[model samples]
Target: MGAAVSDTSTRTTPEHEASRTPSPPGGRSRLAALGRAVARRRLLVLLLTLVVVAIAAALGGDVAQRLSSGGFTDPKSESSKAERFLADRFKSGVPNLVLVARAPGSVDAPSASAAGRELTERVAKAPGVLSAGSYWTMPGAAPLRSRDGRSALVLVRLGGSEDDFRATAKRLVPKVGGRQGVLDVSVTGSAQVSVEIEKRSEEDLAKAEAITAPATLLILLVVFGSAVAAALPLAVGLLSVLGTFLVLRLLSAVTSVSVFSTNITTALGLGLAIDYSLFVVTRYREELASGRDVTEAIAQTVRTAGRTVLFSSVTVALSLAGLLVFPLYFLRSFAYAGMAVVALAAVGAVVVLPALLALLGRRIDAWNINRALRRLVPHRRERGPATEESGFWHWLATAVMRRPVLFALAVVAVLVTLGLPFIRASFGITDDRELPASAPAHVAAQALRDDFDSGESSALSVVLPETDADAGRVGSFAARMSALPGVFRVDAATGSYVNGRQVAQPGPAAVRFRAPGATWMSVVPSVEPYSDAGTRLVQRLRGAPGAPGTVLVGGQAALLVDTRDALAAGLPWTGLIIAGTTLVLLFLFTGSLLIPLKAVVFNLLSLSATFGAMVYVFQDGHLQWLVGDFTVTGLLDISMPVLMFCVAFGLSMDYEVFLLSRIREVYMETGDNTRAVALGLERTGRLVSAAALLFATVMAAFATSGLTLLKLLGVGLALAVIMDATVVRGLLVPAVMRLAGRANWWAPKPLRRLHERLGLKEA
Candidate 1:
């Protein structure tokens, strides 16, 4: 009876198993478990974070709208206040528009007069136009009378928002009748310039998207060696950028966020998303090769690589937060925006990405379709034991160990040489020449300079007492200012009024000075605007002879001078904050003081090389065409260096974390420095190279952008990454660590305890 029952049971078991079908336990099961875990947690965190971001976005949007509607007014610095007051009081109450007219051959009296009238009438009747006049109507306005009479000018005053004013100008241009010789009609003014900037900004954003999106996609594909895997990172990166824009749009309401910030965020988000995802995917692949079940591999990848990403993001955010030390509103806005993007990228990489990978299962590598092709690729495997003379890494280890100190010194020397140019660096605001020569604003500015004293558009405000008692004092002050070397002319109408009417003529009061050839030497001793020379000039002018009861100097130059001073004052603090914070994060991760110190020193070298290259390229006038078309104005923008420092430092750290994390991993397993460095480099070298290439492509794409500032940023950042990854990290880092040997991991007893408690675990 027992034998009969057993036979029946075996037959029944075979039938049941055949019907049910066994599930594959390789990649699919692990991915599914990972998806479940992430779905459960990510939904809650994402919803919460989205809610917070939404609220912040709404508030920011309101602020931006109010600020924009209020009109664009730069905050008053000490030097700017006086100029602001003068501009408020003396300049025409309406924004000014400039018009130029040309004839086929030569502009004769008849053509000039006809063109002037035609333009004036057209401009005056245009919407938002307050008034329009030609040289014929305003005698002694010699600047408007072209020397050759081939060109004629008309000035129009506009009312309302800049957009309204620009529309009026645009409409007026096409309406002016012209002879067969006239090629085109051009209108230029502050309002028109603003419109052009906005238009150009939109164009730049589109260009950035076009370049960054595909470049990022290509980079991910190359890194993952699989289209599906690559697409996952790209998708997350796009989401990060979209979320960032939405956040920025909202923030723009309450604060002034430059349109440039959007491009920056996009580039950063894509780069970081790719970077974080690469690390995780790489680990995930390693786990699969090691024969881990799908669920186990996914869990291990998240536990290890995901944690590293979290730490890396935190470090970058902290570095960006240091921008808060700056008083500049633009820098502050950038810092907040950048931090938000970094946080989002990190979260997306760890959360949304894992879930998606789980759904894809074995398909993560499905894109690597040729099973035979996949088999041909070498898999990561542990050698019998790490030693000084056994494998591909062993040879590299031996070579580096031979001349560590010399390599270190040579690298330092090279970096120092590159950095030398920055000591003589100078900065200025974006100049008119930054625009394309064909741009109406650029043409108008050139025309104004060539026809007038070159100072008509840029004026200085001199403050004197408003009362009659200070008339003599005011006149003396005006005279002294007029006598200054750069001063072209002085307009001090003590009793003058608009409409040619006399108001209560006060005693000689504050005047406006137009300086055409203003030099940094005359303003302050420094070669840069807002430098020591500018500050000194402000101080001297404040105490000029017959000074008003309260004299103040203000204008564009003054504002720039203030900006320079603010940057100069804040630079030390910013540097210290960035360096200190970087060290703390590095120390926390590596549990070794030496590693953090080495990273900081190496990062500084990379930064110096980048700055020196910029000075040579942008400031010193070398390779101008290769970088992009830019007017070599002999100075850099004051804010650019500060922004570069914070940004470059953070990005350099990104590479450092990537390369060093691998080295640290190898070291923990082997306790062999030489073996670890060589193996680590072998493992991460391709990824780092790929990342650098992607970054370079993204930045170089911006070379075609019309915006000079964006071009500068792109070139500078791209150069830094390439140099750091290839030269500093590839050669110097390993060489120095090889020489340091056991000392590399040395930590004091108290610190060791701390590291044990807080140190990041290896992926």
Candidate 2:
């Protein structure tokens, strides 16, 4: 049962009217007024909150079904255009459905050949199949037959929308896969890969939630020292996650939203809810302990901690908003989910939470677990400081300040050393290897890598939009392409060429390369499709002459190049948005240019260290023992670093705001910088560390995901949070403040006037 609010001083009409008539030298505080409003109508607020949450839960029940499993390519890129060109003009693009067929003996046996041809023809007649070819059907296609002579590939191109392709694959695989006469078959390709990833992601999310929910509740119970207090944050987190799912579901109807965003929604929802709740509830308990009654304690908590929550949420949301600058919806989807969850979490903490606190009052301190712990141990000290100057954090801060230069140098050196490995970091696109080894798609891909002679399924498509079916001109261009380094063969209207020689005359396959004014050829490569050599080959092909008309190259390699260029072009703007907004917001909060600068610098350092650690473990494959096993592709996914930076930087700034707000409060009360730093650390030290530990626990649960990218995100963010809280906030902050001294709070005269007029500080 919840406690009833007995304080009637602010509930009376006369008192409320007097409170509204504000005249205190400084302007009226909106946050404090909001607190009073929630207090005055606590029952209505709770009822409305529950109604909204129930609506969200209902609307978002089928959100996972609505989400897309892929958005990694820029739809406007040239590679995407070329792909569309092939499917539109020639009714064919790259093979998106592959059947790897094996025989009891050689695939060339009569029974195996008959089964393979039947399989190919069956797939060609399927609803969404554009065209299908195989080792048995296409003459001079030696690469499709594995070197061991037992396995062969049946490549089928499916033409439709992405959703249509997924539907077709789901239908066709079950009907035509498994066994065909004397041949045994396994299915793979982009369609199958997408289906597998979607399934794995859903499984990972369910498992992560199962792990984090009870673990986080137990951690919160320990951190708050009471069951009633701990339950509030979990309630807020549930509301935030469910609310974000509704937002994402609505967004998916209008635009593409990635299924991967669901993982981020759950992780950040719980993490931030716990963070803001810790700040608010802890501050409320402190006010109550300092002798404020239910009403005033709620009001003060809202005025101070609620404002900090507001400012911190803005910083985090802005950082995530930077992802919108990227062309790929994969990254943009995260921006959508992250900003939505942050807004909902802040609202839940600042509004609904205070209302609940008003209803509960001193009952929040009921079911005290720490009291039982104290009784059991009898000698262990209680959590918070007995005095401002006597706590462990206070002692640590003072000790660091005493040797500022040494502490700063030592901390910087450690961070820089951790960041060294990132200098050699390489980037590539994710493939089937992102799935667990046991996944069917991954198993099929491994068979291709080991058995196949060349990467035929991942060939480059060079389209000449205005070219006709002229034998001389087409054959010349095909010869030049086949001569290029890493190219295995080129299939054109004229013929199939290898090493600058026409090895076979035009056949049935060559007929597919021409339609009206448009013609296309596929340049198959011998190198790994997503490797460094493949990239180099794409660059060379783009520059190679001998085109009858305009040449547009498209494939996995071209897509990689275009995506990389797009990211490079958009990165400056993303950085500008994040950095510019962060500077302006921090200045408004602290009324100090130097403090904001220091915060940004420290955040960059912390994030660089996180990136370096990721490169070391995920990129170079050093710690598979600790983070679990994964295929070491020798290059990290190109989108992952950018995604991680935005998420981790925003979270690191969350801790910065928490520490700086408390320090500014102390400094405003006492003019001594050293004492403010020490006292602030003493007050919030346990709280920040506890918040980071709990958030890290949530991220760590997701780190156990079978998807390597998800694992990288979890491990990287967990490291960033812990390092920021302990090393950067706890150690470097005090040392830097000691060295900066009085200048840390200084600004120009005009800026100071502006700050005094419109700054976001509490009175």
**Best candidate, lDDT:** 2
Question: Highest TM-score: which candidate?
Answer: 2
lDDT tens digits by residue: candidate 2, 1-763: 0001111122223212221222343433677778888988999999999998999999997798889888888889988999899998899988888889999999999999999999999999999999999999987754699999999999988887677788889889988778789988988898888888888999998998898878888899999989999999988898899999999999998999999999999999999999999999999998899999888888889988998998999999999999999999999999999999999999999999999999999999889998888778859656875666667998888888878899999999999999999999988876788999998888988899888988887889998888887746888988998999999999988888999999988887778888998888889998977788988998888888877888888998888989898899889999999999999999888778898899889988998899999999998999799888888888898998899889988998888889888887766655556777887888888889999999899898877799998899899999999999999988999999989876777777788767766777754
- C-alpha lDDT (0 to 100) for residue 755 of candidate 2: 74
Question: Model 2 compared with the native: what TM-score?
Answer: 0.95
The C-alpha RMSD of each candidate to the native structure, in angstroms, is 12.0, 6.5
Angstrom error at residue 384, model 1: 15
lDDT of each: 0.64, 0.87
User: After best superposition, candidate 1 residue 414: deviation in angstroms?
Assistant: 2.1
State the number of backbone clashes in model 1: 23
